[model samples]
Target: MSHAHDLVPFFEFHLYGKEQIPDLSNLPEPRLFSTHFLFHSLPDSIAKSKCKIIYICRNPFDSCVSVVFHQCNCTIIITQIILEEALERYSEGINEFGPFWTNILGYWRESIETPNKVLFLKYGDLTGDVTFYLKRVAEFLNCPFNSEEEGNGVIENIIELCSFKKMKELDVNKTGKMVGKYENKVFFRKGVAGDWVNHFNPWMVEKLSSVIEERWVWSIFLISLSNTYISIMA
Candidate 1:
């Protein structure tokens, strides 16, 4: 979810492509990778590889608010546009590598067709039940902890190590600049589920809901997400 300006510091890897080709030669095994390419546009090698791919998506409402904050805080040129203007550009897919719903379709369908290879996650569900998803992800990676490791709290240690609270407190996150335009610290903003409620008015919510439903109703993942949004807001 980190933007171009703050990606490197947030993920601790040098930022290279914004959906461009990934050059992963000579990288360490068990190397982590990140990209913003939509499923259809992903590199042929990666798509055909036996490797596992995990795609995490956020609720559209919160995504809007997050983009607004990041732009206002990080870029002087982007700061001039009001939230309303930004939302329009967002809906048009004119924002930063956006057209959010489009970016999701390929991966979303792939997750359904090849459930074992493509693991789809929601930011809401992950934060809501990190431990459960952590175990699920570990299992998918073929490194599930043995009973002895579970009893020894190895998973808990890993979760604690990567928790938002811990990451936010790290010296690198606090003091590092991303070698881009923005500070690393901005990527850690308000890591919560319902932050959209603070910025989105009733009309905005209904508008975004309609748009999301229209564009993303094909996948079971997005259908469930739309239902969750309705139930929570109701």
Candidate 2:
């Protein structure tokens, strides 16, 4: 997902819809891009190549709440719609690409089974140690992260650039438009981890847990493997 203002200095091919993937023959071999497109729908090249895939996910309950705020604040169609209606629209996958669960599960499975290509990340982990994970991402993508600069300011730069507060404050993000027409959207909503604790009740949490158990077991494993890899690499 673009995650509102998350699209800044990092992007290339943006294929989120089912329409078409324009002529990429002119594009460079190793291209970078973001998409709400699920793994099942990704281009065949993605799976076969050595390209790195960073699949970031949050707890469904928290994701759902954040998504609610995102829809209301960013989307033109849902801006005037009631929260319930907006949620219904969300469940129906009326947004940028399609249904959230299907997309989430698709990547979850692919990332777990194919670790060399996909690196599944958690929003909570990134929030905890933004710099560390950013470095990990660099390593995963085979991008240069000079060992000589470990104590230097590189980490700080990335953290500051990618910080929720900073990204949200960007004039372009705060006012720029995307899939929807509303410009009031902010990429960084309360980027706190476990914010779901404040909103989810027993029933709701149980429901979300059941869904995760049924469809996201592989994703959970991928997260575990990712954590291990990060620790070892670090």
Candidate whose lDDT is highest:
1
- Estimated TM-score per prediction? 0.81, 0.71
- Give per-residue lDDT, candidate 2, residue 194: 85
Model 2 Cα shift for residue 176 (angstroms): 2.8
What RMSD does model 1 have?
A: 7.5
Question: Model 1 over residues 1-234: C-alpha lDDT tens digits?
Answer: 343334322222354424564455655578666667777776677798898999998888888888887877655543333766777777777865658988777677688778889999999999999999999999988898899999999999999988889888877776556555567777787889888887776777777888878777755566678768988999
What's the lDDT for candidate 2? 0.66
- Mind giving the per-residue lDDT tens digits that candidate 2 earns over 129-160? 87778888888888858976776887787678
Q: Residue 128, candidate 1: how far off, in angstroms? A: 1.0
Error of 1 at 94 (Å): 1.5
Which run of 10 residues does model 1 get worst, by summed lDDT?
3-12
After superposition of all CA atoms, the RMSD between model 2 and the true structure is 7.1
Cand. 2 TM to true fold: 0.71
lDDT of 2 at 43: 62
Candidate models: Cα lDDT each: 0.75, 0.66
